[model samples]
Target: MKNNATLCFPAFLIGTLATLFGGEIVSAAIYSITNTTLTVRYDDATQTFSVTETATGQTFLIGGKLEGEAVKATVTGRTIIVTQADGSTASLELRENVPFVFVHKTLRNAGTTTTYIQRVVPLTFTLDLRQPAAEPRTMGTAGLTAPDRRPQHRPDHQQANQAVCSSAG
Candidate 1:
């Protein structure tokens, strides 16, 4: 039985999103991190998250919510970290200047004895792909631009990168 497990989303894709859509910052139970072309938000009360296109205000996630109840929420720079009652934590970080956000989740077993984690679902969200209008594109280091998904678009890859943690035997 492992004590900890970690899962992370692709940094490059979200980083690209941040670089393309830019905006200001706001505060409240629902926190927002905006890049040049997109906005990422986390609702502490509901333990939910969402990504929106700044131009059209169209959100990419529908009925999005984390799997657990959030006990605490912390913000540092452009990152938001939410801690759950089970000692698990989820972090969403938005890079500066660049366009994308980095999402990471850590599942922890706080009990003294070995606990078998049936499954730790970090988030549950239905992706809203109503107005898919983005094309696959890339940018150089010097400058960058997102796809022409004015009304909206979707990420090229459906899955995110996973980081496995060694068990404390």
Candidate 2:
């Protein structure tokens, strides 16, 4: 019984350690661009990635097994590299506070040369957190409605007449 217990303890410890830190750590974020919402995820260990468009429900896999070939992903500091099975590669460098979309395309007439460009764009993000809801407020007593606050538009002739009158005065 003592020998069996000792054998099981090492296995249990190894299993526990693997469970604690074994696979790649994945981080994901949802970014909004114009009318599209994209969810992108990066695997820290493998450096492979995928992006899903929420509107179309389409997913694109990059340098992963899902591409029907084994690919290797590596990260050195802020730079990530993904080497495809065909010896092709893609890379991305992390930038501070800058939102960008990686556009990958094959160069026309370039014979298998592919290019990856980072296009910086504005993004909006929302976080889900528990917070106290605010009570709705009633309209103020100032009698200012939505239309009253809007700028009034004048005709071109009226503006011209006002300008002439002001200049004359």
The models' CA-based lDDT, in order, is 0.62, 0.31
lDDT of 1 by residue, 1-169 (tens): 5678777763311111122224753323666766666777776555667877777988776556666777877766677788888788888777766656577888776656555453446666776667554633435442454444223323532233333444566
Over 1-169, each residue of candidate 2 has an lDDT whose tens digit, in order, gives 0110000000000000111335764332211221134444445343334444446655543332122122554444433444545444444333333333342211112223323322212112232223332422223344444434534545754544331101111
Task: Compute the lDDT of residue 15 as modeled in candidate 1.
Answer: 15
C-alpha positional error of residue 148 in candidate 2 after TM-score superposition, expressed in Å: 35
Position 169, candidate 1: lDDT: 66
Deviation of model 2 at 163, angstroms: 59
Give all candidate RMSDs, comma-separated.
11.1, 24.1
Cα displacement (angstroms), candidate 1, residue 17, comes to 24
- Off-target runs (Cα >4 Å) in candidate 2 are 1-40, 43-70, 101-169
TM-score of each candidate structure, all chains considered together = 0.59, 0.26
